[model samples]
Target chain A: MSAGALPPRVRIVEVGPRDGLQNECVALGIDDRLTLIDRLADAGLRDIEAGAFVSPKRVPNMAGSGELMQRLPRRAGVSYPCLVPNDTGLDAALAAGCTDIALFAAVSETFSQRNTACSIAESMDRLSAVARRALDAGVRVRGYLSCVIGCPYEGAVESRKVADMAARLIDMGCYEVSLGDTTGIGTPAQIAALIDTVAAQVAVTRLAGHFHDTWGMGAANVWAALQRGVTVFDASVGGLGGCPFAPGASGNVATEDLVYMLDGAGIETGIDLRALVDTARWISARLDRAPASRVARAFPPTPER
Target chain B: MSAGALPPRVRIVEVGPRDGLQNECVALGIDDRLTLIDRLADAGLRDIEAGAFVSPKRVPNMAGSGELMQRLPRRAGVSYPCLVPNDTGLDAALAAGCTDIALFAAVSETFSQRNTACSIAESMDRLSAVARRALDAGVRVRGYLSCVIGCPYEGAVESRKVADMAARLIDMGCYEVSLGDTTGIGTPAQIAALIDTVAAQVAVTRLAGHFHDTWGMGAANVWAALQRGVTVFDASVGGLGGCPFAPGASGNVATEDLVYMLDGAGIETGIDLRALVDTARWISARLDRAPASRVARAFPPTPER
Candidate 1:
């Protein structure tokens, strides 16, 4: 790759409010959730996954996402997308006035079975109805393909299978397909091959990378995606949220850390790194844990010296 | 760059024993140092920085490095190198029957003053004498240039100055020059520029990447170096050794994590990752802290189900 082939700018889809907090041990109050979304918006993130519309019985941490969406202040250029797993979830999101929605399916049969309690095909069939309804309602739809790199139960996954699944999602009216390394087990070489395979079917511009930091390969995997011309990325504030299915796995790639690297690379992300760090610290303290973002710890905001 | 441009194999200089323990909160006993070295050798790391020969008053953790080196069981193909800061350190190493030695300097004047208590020119002059004496004694000398990307005190460092320092080290009979991100403040773009600038004066093969994970950019920076044809790297076991100068910074990139990424990228490192992870867990437990290597935590060895 030419050194100059890197994108001049990249879009960051903040997923902490949904993906990050979903697995948190302590449930953040609705006001705390609103603060997170508002802080992320204030930090200049244009796209934020506010929350999901799944049953509170399954994911209690995201119980009042609809209320959060209702109370969330509308920013001029910001888009807050809510994840909708089925028709009921989508209906709730619509009732809450969500203009953007995300539907997720796993590329591997084992992950689809264990995570969604359905086969890959069955899950896709379910999501298709949700996607159709969202599109009909004029809501922007984003597809999430879990286990795009590897599955905890199934080990390695074929890149072609991931690419085919991504293509199907795009055909099902997803404006963009986010390939999620749900188990956080991807490497740069695997990422390159996966992106190349998926880009062959779906346009690279329509793909976003959502890597977890379980193995500390998140930023490196993002670099691999950037090299392959995938511009949009999904990261979480404070690196919150581990995969409940993948025990011992860490959280999603921290948005603050990603922004630090991107800013240092001279790429335009339009994110205030300091503000993101503050939000990360704020949420992490409320959760009674250290912020998982290394940059936030390493370069903590210094008082005016 | 062609996908095949990546090197088929890479050499890792495991520096956990020397660079790692030097800055630790607890001073591991001599037996612990030997066990760490022996375990690293068992894990198929041919090149390991076994210890250092600095003043014990300054670095108490490395006080028994000479004795540890003397008693270390000589392996058939393994090479243990000790960090030698000056002629006295080199003399101590020689008295202890060590053959491989590393001399370190910083590209920035402020780091030289703070870390070595000497100016850049003065430190280089002292190291020049040590290098000559060591080469006369048939010892292999390796040069370490700290703060190649950024300095804790001086902030951003010029790539040209770093290259000049590396070229000088090579000219002084160092077999290889390792560029160190002592503060771990480097980005992939900066790594690329640093490698590109240094390769202009020295062959890329004679250069090694020694990055810290303080900002979680170590692996990404390593990826950039690999793309620029750098095939040698330095990492610590369990991601040990926080920087004394840079508060709240993480340690060197964990050797297990680096090996995991390299192995997944299909690069031959000749390392047994399971053994490395076991060693990391063992030492981390002894230190009363969790292993910083995320892979070790995520994929802990499980008994056959």
Candidate 2:
């Protein structure tokens, strides 16, 4: 650590509109999801994950990502980010004319096999092409590493592997990488140690935390990461994402809750929590179930037309 | 700080058997609830909250608390604590032959009014009487102070007020005091500051953290409390409590999840996490909705019985 260097103020990447709601059985229209994004941008989030471009057959909730991105207001300060699983998804993202595309790879073999049907090396090899294509097209690329802390099947991932994989993503031309506790299996100490180890190999600012609340340690891990100099976090709005280890294993950390924490701490995330809550309600009503995020469930107010 | 003194270890007061299932809209039989408590004790939670001795009309979910207490297995090493809201509830718990009983008091005027239909001062006075009676009956008393950090009606509570409440509970001869973030508005810094202030007037061991995951900082707050030498935590089995203020607000952190983190950190929670998950599933199935606890929902084993 630099002597007396001021820690970088954390920036939260709101993934609620995208990764959060994507796995729900809910079927939200394109407009409602986009409005949610617009509200999030207006609320203060500079980087808002719009949606993921994927197969509706697999992720029906994310089927409207392309349309949602096109209709989005594209607020002056807000950056609309979308996820692309592989080269095919990246092509869809670029076709939609998104300048910023995110690629995902799992750190745990079990999760990678379950989510992508590939090994870690194989998944990265596929995402490398996506990153390269996006970079060539003059687009920004971010990397997501899932299950960096604990895997549902394997459990207690080694920190060294996480750091090595994060370094590899950076070397592959990704602008930033988010380390995810996909199963919500990390303690503050484990998170601090992972960040410390990964920071040794990559710039601390390039690393972010993607924590699930399965074990209710999502925000705690984020706090530990921030203390270790991580400045970026990925949170789902109303904690929309469900655990693919099967939904309900551990849900995503609700974006509203994360913003509340950041706002209370005097951190600069530029996100309006009230706006996020409105988005959560709109999508939740469509799903015919409650918003999975704890904060959205706690604070529900109708949005003004 | 004593150089050679070992840092204080946090204690897990599993509230699943009592608090978790008590507020559910569904009605569960007494034997099922007793079985749940027995399983929790087997999982190694030394302080297992057995049941709540309240009016059946008010909290129908807890109608059979007295019978549940009478039916649950008596383990020599474990303390089966039951919740007593007033003198009548205390007598009911004593009639059931419970050795340990807990008393409830809310800090927020609004919460106390809604929860007990009385002023905070009035509730405290009643709890004091119950505490005195419990002491005379040779029953251990644990005091609960809800809305310690923030309230739904009134936001941003004072730490000194929480300290004062803890002092009163202790002064009334309670063995320990549990401070709750009932509405889940507290952050890590705020929690640390609150615990530090409370610890100044009372012994740290006597203080416990009971945080709701409504805003996703429950576990983080618990971590903060752990750092402050608070060894006791009050957690529900399936994240089953709700905030009356914010309709549908999440309840306390899930017990299985807490056990996972504590176990991972080498903290001795004395819980067999797999067993806890089973109990959570069994209770949830009977409730007609899967347990709200993410960990339990994620890892439900098909209970053969």
lDDT per residue (tens digit) for residues B226-301 in model 1: 9999999999989988643455668899998899999888999999998898899888887777787788888767
lDDT of 1 at A74: 94
Provide the TM-score of chain A alone for each candidate, in the order shown. Answer: 0.96, 0.89
Off by over 4 Å in 1: A243-247, A302-305, B243-247, B302-305
lDDT by residue (tens digit), candidate 2, B69-132: 7777788988998899988898899999999999888888888899899998998988888888
Q: Which regions of candidate 2 fall more than 4 Å away from where they truly are?
A: A1-9, A16-18, A21-36, A51-73, A84-96, A108-137, A150-156, A243-251, A303-305, B1-9, B52-73, B85-95, B109-133, B152-155, B242-249, B300-305
Q: Rate the local accuracy (lDDT) of all candidates.
A: 0.90, 0.78
What DockQ does each prediction reach against the true complex?
Answer: 0.71, 0.39
Each prediction's TM-score versus the true structure: 0.97, 0.85
Q: Candidate 1 clashing pairs?
A: A1-B1
Which candidate achieves the best TM-score against the true structure?
1
**Candidate 2: lDDT of A183?**
69
